[model samples]
Target: MHDGIVVYPTDTLYGLGGDALSDEAIMKVFEAKGREYHKPISIAVSDPDMIRAVACVDELAEEFIDQFLPGPVTVILPARTILSSWLTAGTKKIGIRYPNHEIALELISRFDSPITATSANLSGGPDPVSLDLCTVPYDCAINAGPLSGIPSTVVDLELREIIRAGAEIDAVAAFLAQWS
Candidate 1:
């Protein structure tokens, strides 16, 4: 986020990113995208270990992540002590991902906290797959060429089940199946 705001293509869509732990920066994302405060956002980290720093990651979740991360998968887990209520929407849990893109990985590494991965589009709109088609109302956009074009598979580790199907399932499924 050269302009002090970061935007990048995620597994699901182009995401308007910012300091995950910053209330002000997070507020800006909500204002810029016109997103509702009630709906919590997801965060992306460069490594699975980073997930533990932000949330209370369990052994099972770690196992799944060891196999599925650095790819299309968003794991929902309990938030750690420091997450803002704004990020969790009053819930005790948070959604996290490690996108399979070098640029995204680098951004998360640089930011040093889980970065928000909410779609760049306004609420209830199609995700932008290309810069030409991107319509996010933001001051900066970190275009990493075309996206992988497939959304990350969303799995609720809280309940140990898959909530939304996306591009990479076999990989995630195989990981989760090991838990059973």
Candidate 2:
């Protein structure tokens, strides 16, 4: 991401992202994908601490996160850190992930900051499973074979609603219900 945006493999699909903390880098990802800055982008974090650094997780949100993360799920939480509106896209919430893929997690673990976690594809285009299918301009790409093409399940825990039922929604709700 230092050089520019990179297309990396995640548990769900290939994602186009850069330094999540760098507004300039984030903008480059936006430009590369022809994406508007007003659209919020998700982030890939390395660990629980990393998740806490960027988002404010309440007790209810924490239960779902503790039970269903490091898997194929994108949990949207209130933004706690002061990041550019470009990252959160004017919304007070940020979608966060801790992808189960080792490569994805290691990249963020080493970088010591979140990385953009939006799918690697053109704006309004289908999500790419293979690096070869990506149309965005990226400085680097790490391919790990083909993905299932099913995006992660997206949940807005603050609202206790399922935004996108990609993977493991019922279990997530059931788990959260335990604490609810």
- TM-scores for all predictions: 0.90, 0.94
RMSD of 1: 2.0
lDDT scores for all predictions?
0.79, 0.86
How many backbone clashes are present in model 2?
Answer: 0
| Model 2 steric clash pairs | none
Q: What is candidate 2's CA lDDT for residue 36?
A: 85
lDDT of 1 by residue, 41-129 (tens): 88888997888888888788877777778777888999997888898999888999888877888878887777788777777767678
Name the runs in model 1 displaced over 4 angstroms. 1-4, 178-180
Q: What is the lDDT of candidate 2?
A: 0.86
Cα TM-score of candidate 1: 0.90
Summarize candidate 2's per-residue lDDT along 26-68 as a digit string, tens digits. Answer: 9888888898878999989989888888899788777777888
